[model samples]
Target chain A: TQLLEQSPQFLSIQEGENLTVYCNSSSVFSSLQWYRQEPGEGPVLLVTVVTGGEVKKLKRLTFQFGDARKDSSLHITAAQPGDTGLYLCAGASEAAGNKLTFGGGTRVLVKP
Target chain B: EPEVTQTPSHQVTQMGQEVILRCVPISNHLYFYWYRQILGQKVEFLVSFYNNEISEKSEIFDDQFSVERPDGSNFTLKIRSTKLEDSAMYFCASSRDSGLQAFFGQGTRLTVV
Candidate 1:
């Protein structure tokens, strides 16, 4: 079983502050996706990183896939209250039939 | 934009009773999946369905759990018997393909007593 581990399980930061969430795994994946979920709701996909050493930016949010495709990261610039949510990283491995294995998740609370 | 929709936002049931959760995936999506998240836990994959049958399932999807795409647009998950541990937020998702991003429904919160 491939396991994804996230760092800083819980984070509380003031609005306008920057934060980075990390997702790491020992197994290689074909793709990595970041999702944000609020209470009482399902996760919303934020971004998908496919190629190794690839970086994609979505306005203030930047996502990166590691060179080995075994790790990924999300960096939020000037965080806002609206960004507060549970951030999850899921890895899809072709070896595992392209099934997704999600990380433990990071709870971010942006305080204004 | 199109989205996945789930029915019965919240369900409270007895431990031994059966429960059926429903979902309407995106009109054009071909892949469908069911996932659950116990409170304070990570989301866990249950099963994946396609071509009117199951394509994949996780260890958590045992004999008591089954999935059916009864109609062209509707997908359903049935739990033969509920257990206290079954209480969680059940989410239905769909994607155009296995490598694409999956769109998730709001989810059905199941509370078993």
Candidate 2:
């Protein structure tokens, strides 16, 4: 099974702090997606980076895919209480039937 | 701003009972999927459906679990017999095309006792 390992299983930071979450995998993926899920809610897509070394940004959030396509990262600049949530990284492997294999996730708590 | 929608935000059922979780995918989407996240755990993939048939399923998707697109708009996940381990928040998602990012519904929390 393809597995993605996420770093910093738990994080607590004051408002305005910058944070980065990592997702690493041994297997190469055809595409990778990042999602943020709030309590009692389904995850919402943050970004999808398909190309190696690709970078995409949304406001204070930025996502990057590894050059080998075996890893990804999510960086949040100036995190606010609104940014607190469970952040997950998912990969769609070429051999995994386009099915998404998710990482364990990183729970972020941004205190104001 | 179209988004996937799920019904029965929360469900509570006894063990051995059958339960169905419902979702309404985005009107223009053709690919649908189901995933479950136990509290404090990772989200796990259950199944993916397209063209009215299951395209893929994870090991977690045993005979007890099934998915159906009853019509043009609704997608359903049926658990034939609930187990205590089955209690989790089940999410429904859909994509406009394969290999693209999917939009998810709010999720249906299933509690089996």
Candidate 3:
């Protein structure tokens, strides 16, 4: 089974502090997606990385995909209270037939 | 923006009872998926549907679980016999094509007592 494991299941930080969450796996994927979920709601897509060693930035959040497609990371600069949520990483592979394998998620709490 | 929509934000059903979860995917999307997250657990894929048929399913999707696209816009998941373990937040997602960014609905919280 393809498994994506996220480190630091929970994180707490003061506002303006930076935080980084990592997703690692032994199985290679075709693409990796990052999502943030609020309590009682479904996950909202944040970014998707397809190319190896690619990096994308969205304002305060930066996403990086490993060259082997086996890992990814999300780095938040100057995290605000609004950035607090459950961050999840999911991997997609053609062999999986459109199904996404999700990580356990990292719950971040930014205190104001 | 176009997004997936799910009906009945919360559902409460008894064990062994039948429950059907409904979802309407984006009009332009062709692939639909069902995923669930047990409390404090990772989100797990249940099934993926395309072209009016099931493209893939996880082991969690057993005989009691079934998916159908009865119409052009509506996609539904039926649990013939619900169990307490089935209580979780069920999310519906859709994408324009395979391996693309899939948009998700707010989700339906299913509680099986």
| Interface DockQ per candidate | 0.76, 0.77, 0.84
lDDT of candidate 1 at residue A6, scale 0 to 100: 99
CAPRI tier for the interface of model 2: medium
Stretches of candidate 1 exceeding 4 Å from the true structure: none
Q: Residue B36 deviation, candidate 2, in Å?
A: 0.8
Q: After superposing candidate 3, which stretches have Cα over 4 Å from the reference?
A: none
lDDT of 2 by residue, B39-78 (tens): 8888889999988899899899999999988888899999
Tens-place lDDT per residue, model 1, A43-107, is 99999999999999999999999999999999999999999899999998878867778999999
Clash pairs for candidate 1? none
lDDT of 3: 0.94
What is the Cα-based lDDT of residue B29 in candidate 2?
Answer: 89
* Candidate 2 lDDT (Cα, 0 to 1): 0.93
Query: Top model by DockQ, which number?
Result: 3
| Model 1: docking quality category | medium
lDDT of each: 0.94, 0.93, 0.94
User: Could you give the DockQ of candidate 2?
Assistant: 0.77
DockQ of 1: 0.76
Q: What is candidate 1's TM-score against the reference? A: 0.97
Please tell me how candidate 3 rates in CAPRI terms. Answer: high
